[model samples]
Target chain A: MQRATLNRMTPYAFMAPAAIVMVIALLYPLLYMVWGSFRDWNPAQTIGETEFVGFKNYITLFYDPAFRESLSVTLRFAVIVVSVEMVIGVGLALLLDRNIRGMSVLRTLFILPMMIAPVVVGLMWRYMYHPTVGTFNRWLKSIGLEGVDWLGQNALMSVIIADIWQWTPFIFILALAALQSLPRSALEAARIDGATPWQQIWHIKIPLMMPVLIVTCLLRLIDAFKVLEVILVMTEGGPGLSTEILALRISRTATEFRELGVAAAMSNYLLILLLILTAAMFAYTKIQEAREARIRAAAEEDM
Target chain B: MPTIRLDNLVKRYGAVEVLHGIDLSMEENEFTVLVGPSGCGKSTTLRMIAGLETVSDGEIYINDKPVSHLEPKERDLAMVFQDYALYPHMNVAKNMSFALRLERRPKAEIDQKVREVAEVLGLTPYLHRKPGELSGGQRQRVAMGRALTRDSATFLFDEPLSNLDAKLRGQMRAELALMRQRVHKNMIYVTHDQIEAMTLADRIVVMHGGYIQQQGTPEELFKRPVNKFVAGFLGTPPMNFLDADIVERDGTVWVTGKGFELALDGEHADAVRAHRAKQITVGIRPSDLSFDPDAANENSFELRVIVSEYIGAQSVLMCDCGGQQVVVELKSETPIPLGETLRFSVNPAGVHLFDKESENAI
Candidate 1:
């Protein structure tokens, strides 16, 4: 009896370290932020001294036009970037999934951008987008064309393009792996079934790759929502809040405005939005698994 | 239906040539099966005809039109892969209707075609089930249904029923033969199983070592095998070979070896008389040897029975004839005790001769 009891407790003992880390590292800060969001607190005051304000911070944020504009900017940035990146990434994968000389080397080079540090990518793009002396302006001037302000007029788009450039490679490698793992015989069958090249891609390749593509899109959206470093370095949320995404706004509220409670309230709002997305991704996978299970059950029932 | 012709077809991979110049012409609506051991270019030839592989050297003509450079879609052919390559995402109905839908046919017409073929293949009940949801036999039927839905001029099958269990394979093979009779398009099938070829083919192409060894009807290849390989490859218990020499005894030719001698008929007298080599190999099928207990026939041997394997109504007895292995297939009721020497008669028409050095039938 004692040995059986120990066997059952052995798994729990092994899991205790992870459970403690989760409580301290993840759950503690989340609980602290939730509590802080209900109080009218300054950064200088301790939690015990701060007085509870009862939804005042959330109410102020709802009425604040600057916060609303930042919210819209963040949503628009995530949508456009994810859509464009998925298309270009999957398209590049389909195009490059073949045997050729130096193909593995080429694939490695394509994914090199994703391996670079994000801050370095931001700095590299910042130099390229320089108005007077950068690569784009210099090339434009040498070609006898008028140089437009890359950072000033098109700051949001410039930041978006930079994010796509850095993150598109992540999607590319995954899409390539998915493409390579597709059954070779099915493609051969499709060829013999009278499907043209375009038809094969539209009907067979893309439809078969839909499951992986959906998961990839959701992950990119989640990453896009929390993006801060590159946009912060390139635009500094500048050019009159054109590129001030939600993460940047939250950071500025806590540091520059010295409003800890309001920043925590804003963070909660962003967290709620992200929770919906994460839930949708999980729900999609669960529904897929359930469908497969039901199918197997039905087959068994038939037998 | 278009007749298919492969004129000196060749396939090369960068440096190595897998298919050295293969030439074959198949008649319209004929079931031509390419049979060979592995790496013998049988599958490669079928894929080339299906337009899945590039013909590096010669041209393919369907109904006398050069089609080597045409795309598979343009050539209008459908293939059943070794692995039933059903669309795992789509249900059976959608899977079968994919080709028609791509052509943008009317919805009613597409539904009619899908229903017709589904019924024919007995896949109607599983029309709403995905490939992953179906059993192996059902998936095999779905593959056949997909091919039948296409009205292509030619059909290619790359060992379509090889994945099923033994009993299921036999059942599916029967169904395939029935379907072949119902839908008579130009069919090219590839397999290593000689039984599959002999049962279903209108013409059999025997391939070996990147070359075509022989091509004829199954009866022709079985009765008059061109060389030693075809003679040995086609039978169930397989042909037995013994080292022997042909010599003149009085006025007739006698095949003399370590075991016994057999008199050759008048028809093969000159063929053996003019042979350049002094030594030759003799071939005999297992079914040609009959157990004659009375022991009163010419060209009869005393076969020592060693082991008896009972297979239902028939039993096969393994025996030794003068230190060489010989097999006899007979009814199980004739019981001779083990270790008993019995007399077995030989049929002259079943005797085959080959040159020892060349391994070719004389």
Candidate 2:
């Protein structure tokens, strides 16, 4: 009996180190943030010295017009960026899915933007979006068109465009992988079934790729909400908070505004939103797996 | 129905030519089976006809009109792939109606056509189920149903029944034959299984190494193959080949080898006399060799039975004739002593002869 008990304990003992590291690295900081969200604290003082405030920071954020605007901006940015990127990425994948010489090189070049650090991407785009001597304005001038103010009046659109450029390749590579992995014979059959090229893509390829595209959309949405570095560097939430996203607002509230408690509460809200999205993704996958399992079981029963 | 013709069809993948100048023509409302081993260009030829693979050289003519430049949709053909290739996202009804829907046919017409096809293929009950939720046989039926709903001039099948289990394959093969009778448009089916070719084809075109070896009625091809490859490739317990020499002795042509001698008469003798080479390959089907102890040496083989596979009514006996391996299909009731020489008489009419160097029928 003792030996059996020892054998049972062996697995848990082996798992102990990982569990302990997870607590230190992930759980501890998460609990600290949650604890800090309920306190009236500032960066200047220790958490122990701060007075406990019971959801005051949350209530303030809920009613703050600036916070509401920032939330709407984040949502708009995520929605626009994700939808536009999906269309362009999937379209590019469909166009480039065929055989051509130097295709591998072309694919590698296409995904190059995604490999750059986010900070570098931000700085590069900031330079390109410059009004007087930027790449876009200079090109416009050379083309005999008047240069427009990119960062002044159209700061949100400019930031959204930059984000799309940096992240479109992520969806492009994944969509291409999914497209290539589809059954080749099915496409061939569709071709022989009197489907035009457009019909094949619309009816067969898009529908078949829906599952992968949905998961990819959800992941990009989540990442888009948490985006801060690129927008921060490009616009700095500048020209009266026109491009201030939730992540940017959170950082500013903690540092510039000197309200650590409000920032923590804002972070908690963002975390909850993300958790819901993640749960939806997981639930979608679980439903898919269960359906497939049921299908297999039903098929086996028939046999 | 339009008669489809391939005039010297060629397919090249960059530097390598996989199919070399295939010339074939199918009559309207005829079933043609392109049967061969894997990588034998049978499926490639079928795909070329279906317009799935681009024609590298030569031209395809549908009713004497050049169609090589036409797209698959414009070619008006429907194909059933080896994997069934059913749309996993669509139900059986939707899959069947996809072609009609693309044509923008009236909804009532589409529904009627889909219902008729589903009923015919016994897929009506599963019409609302996605392909992922169906059994292999049901998926195969859906594929057939999809092709049937197209109402195209030509139908192409690329080893459609190959993915099914053995028993299911046989059942589907019979169903395909039944469907072939009901839908008599031009059908070009590809498979490596000779039994499928023999059972379903009005004309069987045997391909090998990217070249068509023979194309004829199944009976004609079976009784009179043009080459050694066709003789061996088209039968169950495939034809046994033995090295032999043709010799004319006393005006009687004799095929003499290590273990047995076969006397040739009529056309075989005339062909052997006109041929230049004495060395030849002797072909005999397993079904043509029967056990008879009293048979003469000229028409019988003394084989030592090595292994007997009992398969219900018929048993296949693996035997050794001299040093070469031989297989014999015989009734299971015939008690054959193992490891001992037994006289198995050859039917004179079933003898086949081929030139040693060219491997062509003599």
lDDT to native, each model: 0.88, 0.91
Q: Which stretches of candidate 1 lie over 4 Å from their true place?
A: A1-16, A46-49, A282-303, B258-261, B296-298, B302-306, B321-324, B339-341
True contacts kept of each: 0.65, 0.76
Best candidate, lDDT = 2
Candidate 1: deviation at residue B154, Å? 1.6
Cα lDDT tens digits for candidate 1, A1-303: 999999999999999999999999999999999999999889899999999999999999999999999999999999999999999999999999999999999999999989888899999999999999899999999999998798898999999999999889888988998988899888888887778888889888998888889889989998999999999889998899889999999999999999999999999999999899889888988998788668756864774
lDDT of 2 at A220: 96
lDDT tens readout by residue for model 1, B1-362: 68889899889988999989999999989999999899999999998988889999999999999999998888888888889998887888888988888889999999999989988888777877889878999998888889889988888899888899989999998998998889989999999889899999999999998889899999999888878888888877788887888788688888878766777777666678777555888888878888887755446777899999999887888998789888887778877689998888787788888889998888
Q: Per-model TM-score of chain A alone?
A: 0.92, 0.91
Isolated chain B TM-score per model: 0.96, 0.98
lDDT of 2 by residue, B281-301 (tens): 999999999999999987888
Evaluate every candidate with DockQ and list the scores.
Answer: 0.49, 0.53
Off by over 4 Å in 2: A1-15, A279-303
